[model samples]
Target: MARPLLRLLAASCALGAMAGSAAAQVADHGAPWLENPFPSTYVPLPRSDVMLRHATILDGAGNRIDDGDVLVRSGKIAAVGRALANPGGAREIDARGRWITPGVIDVHSHDGTYVLPLTTIDREAGDVSEGSDVNVADTWIETAVNPQDTAFSRALRNGVTTIQILPGSSPIFSGRAVTVKPIRATSVAAMKFPGAPYGFKMACGENPKENGAETHRGPTSRQGVVTYVRKAFMDAQQILRDQKGEDGKPGPRRGPPAGRGPDLKREALAGIMAGDLRLNMHCYRADDMATMLSVAKEFGFHITAFHHATEAYKMPAALREAGTCAAVWGDWWGYKMEALDAVRANAPMLDRAGVCVTMHSDSPGSGQRLTIEAAKAAGAGRRMGIVVPPERMIRWVTSNSAKVLGLEDRIGTLAPGYNADLVVWSGDPFSVYTKADLVFIDGAIAADRSAPPASPASDFELGRVAAVRP
Candidate 1:
């Protein structure tokens, strides 16, 4: 049933319960259901004006603006320069001697959907999978996304302003990925980053193979995995061609008519073929990565980035030649057969080869502390005798990831025209001990450690004390 009709049925049932005492008991039980129910509408809250002065700014464009003053007016960056005066009416923040950069963006994340705070029983309906099929390209992560989850707060406190949440790699073609703003809001639409393009979550190697094997599918081996992907693309190509008409004679339209057919798989492949969606493949083996690149070339689609690319260092030249970005972990190794060859210097080696490398934390626990992940990458590079400048290292999480997300024009850098998404660290960002003093999302202060929120339960100690006294 449609959501509105279901809600109407529920309301009618509640109204009908006042006929008798037993009916009144039913009404009492339904009261909690009426409080903050699903499919709730959201109105975005008003943002505050903010200004920061006297900060060491890493602009995410590999340039440093020493002692810069950044002015944010009406939720956008108004000015960024040296020795600038703040507008008199704006709220001012003193960030002297602190490192300020654009808020970090994680290209690969699974925080909101595969959440831990909610009970696991909520996912028992098997909605996480589609029709018992592994390749569910049409399913969107946004549909499963929960905006008001505590993970959103955790991610924002860790300085992540935006994230591209993807489906798990348990399938060959997992689903569509959605980019979201890390903010507490009433609905997912309120938290969505406007105009951000959707990405397709594609996988190779172990994930698809293992899933297919368990289901008695042919793709139990690496070669079988490649064949499965190739067959799907080939069918999609045929479908596209048939829709275009054979010899201009008007053949039967493939899948469904424009905006009419409900075939999710074909619609997803069509989006890819038309270049409306990006493909983010999860692969760790070097040969599998190469195969994915070749397949993308054959299909005339762009490979936006490779996630968990542990063996990316082995094929740095190939990756750079293909103009693909690598979203990899800092130093995770020996956890899987494909990742056995992973090394600590993987990120730096790819960086030195002129390949775009971004540090990604695929785990929810790790996503809450990505600054330390970036620091680990930098430290590993230094230990490997490869000297990457601190500014360049900052780009791996900020500008470079934004570039991979196709959002470089907006939120990656601290330029005048970019979105005022920034973070102020308590100390040097490269040091592991440093913490985020303040975090801003679209020029509005989202978190501040020193000054807590107006709510008494905003801090741990106050919350415990309040409980004890009661």
Candidate 2:
């Protein structure tokens, strides 16, 4: 981690400014870069109070309303119905043929973390894993976040307003993941999602083993990985029992870990045990996910979601019972042994069996068409005489993913109290020719197909790289 970030974390922890009252009790040696500016570069347009009348609306909660009206006031969905009594001063648009849905929430992305110029001839510039020890939970992707990444522009045009930038999963534990609004900002802190809890990344398959083998570490097998995880948490538990409170004395056992951790790794592990940090575990096989669930249960820490779980369909019942969501692709299989047994219906099958299912793009290009990915996954179920409606398929990229990221309360659904993060599609979102005609982030226009929308372009791309589409 960078020295500036460490200084900020130290200052925030010392002043009790990280977040909430619990920050005073939580361990102070991890990623706590919570001092953020307003949503970076996202200018609120004059039409902050606008109403879209007579459109097909997908609430992102499995409800579809034809000829619906959504009124946005003060960056919130004020009303949603067939005929809303519009405010006299609000701007109104007759969206007759368009469809409105909540802005896409990408659960697993490496955009800022693996920023522009991914490859520099010799090595990838933003490889964010400490492979030497395979347990750098103290490290954070935020310090590596390059807000100048041009990928943010493409995603915004595709209706993605929010995304979780996670660390690479090459090691057993990479580090803490940061959530951000996909705005091309001057710095990552300016784009950080307010009030969103921090997440940690953990991988449990071929990548970790390979990294360990290359580094001459001990965790060369799955058993070894499991053993290492157990010991790390147990050690963290002991440390949590040995920290001091903000008043320079041991406080009552309430929320968060007991006190400050001696190191970054211990602080993060303690955060997980305190039950506020979300774990975005990268596992491909069903057996590995099953074992992970058992481990999470033993440690009393929840596994929020399993990323790239290609074989999630094989263990839908277990996943559903464990209350963990699966973030997967349309048909990314056969590339590796663990991911080889996957079928295209993996997502659909998981959906049918009552497991929380979502489609995610670990690749930057694939992320541009995540709606198409969900359409394909739903199409696979259609061939099998099972129907995955567009309304439900939308959740595979919107609500379901948001729930996994712990931002469901604020942004996912197009409800009355949720953030007015929505996209207006020219046609059915699942249709190949459809494009995001107008996108709203917090009720402000972020993109438009008809006009040159606000520039999501980074300062780095302003003069050097011209805008291709807009």
Candidate 3:
């Protein structure tokens, strides 16, 4: 169920206070901070009083408005045109010769779940698995989310305003995923999009096998993987049926509601079955991808996106027909047998076939710099004679990702009524040397390379730089 807007605002306020308190405590200890040195002081100001003028606006809708002025007020884009009525007391920013676009969104990421500055062993500490079963349908990535991680700042620096933090695909049905803002807040609620549906993390091939060897349970083989997912959905259907009365009255409310469950796995699966949760499946091969689509059809649920779909170009028509999204890498290939057919032209081919394709960087190192990934896709498409436009290519990492995460209306474009989440680039964003000059999330400045924020000390980063200096 979606949280009330008031509740979300209150939660954000509480979490902000908690984050401030945590930072103060860490500083009191007089120790170096192990987390990112950036501060997370996001105080939302009145957006009605800000405007960016004389900029080339690349609206993520595949349109470019040159020498335009964008007026934002109350955190929503109010006007975008050549001439603007500047109300009194509005701050006008000179953006001449610069490019403005929606802040980049990474549809596939693992930053929050497997957070750095903490031991990797903590990922396994919580029983993310249920009953020792691989397909834990009730586990939520948000529940285990640690909001104080340093990767949020790094993501902000790279112009990534939002990301879907997914669990590692160690199981066929890994767990639920969360869509989060790459900002500093003390709790998951503050960072979470208020009503965004949770996502089920399903996987195929290598990651599902136990101990790198086939076991007796389902999904030991490729066929087994398909069967396992089908069976689970069938069970969920049965549960759904039993929970509803023949007279159209609710029956005993099933096991439990979302976000509160004795059986964590089933709780997560229930959300999917009820169409309240999206499915973000990870598959590499074309055949497996087809089978997964078939399973979705049999269960009457839609797949939001397929991550790391290296061979998606082969079945672009099918993917397009089903309205499924392909979140893929630009040129990563041959790391395994399933990924052998990965080609540089994959994204272009899919795009030409009218598939909603988005490029993603699954690596921690690569996640912070996905503009380069989009550039690579554009370069590959151009090399293959695809002639994809620059505006269209930018959509692969911005608007298309927002579509996959079901947040297209809010942050993926610089249009009227959209949230003021945008990035100012130092040069043409497609160029290799281009960088983010400023990043705004919900009309608040989150990152400005020209004037960086004061570094906040945590227990682990105190005086270490000075001590190591020559």
Best candidate, lDDT: 2
**How does each model score on lDDT?**
0.74, 0.80, 0.72
TM-score winner: 2
True-structure lDDT of candidate 3: 0.72
Cα lDDT, model 3, residue 61 = 92
What are the TM-scores, per candidate, against the unseen true structure? 0.83, 0.87, 0.83
How far in Å is the alpha carbon of 206 misplaced in model 1?
0.8
Error of 2 at 311 (Å): 0.5
| Candidate 3, poorest ten consecutive residues by summed lDDT | 29-38
- Candidate 3 segments whose C-alpha is farther than 4 A from its true place: 1-48, 117-131, 210-218, 248-263, 457-470
Model 3 residue 391 CA deviation in Å = 1.2
lDDT of 3 by residue, 257-299 (tens): 4664344455456456545568888898888889888877766
* Per-residue accuracy of model 2 over 99-218 as CA lDDT, tens digit each: 999999888898865666656621466655656578988787778877778788789889898888888888798888888887657787778887687888999988888777877875
Every model: Cα RMSD to truth = 12.0, 6.6, 9.6
- Model 1 Cα lDDT, one tens digit per residue, 265-306: 865775565455678999998999999898887776678899
Ranking by lDDT: 2, 1, 3
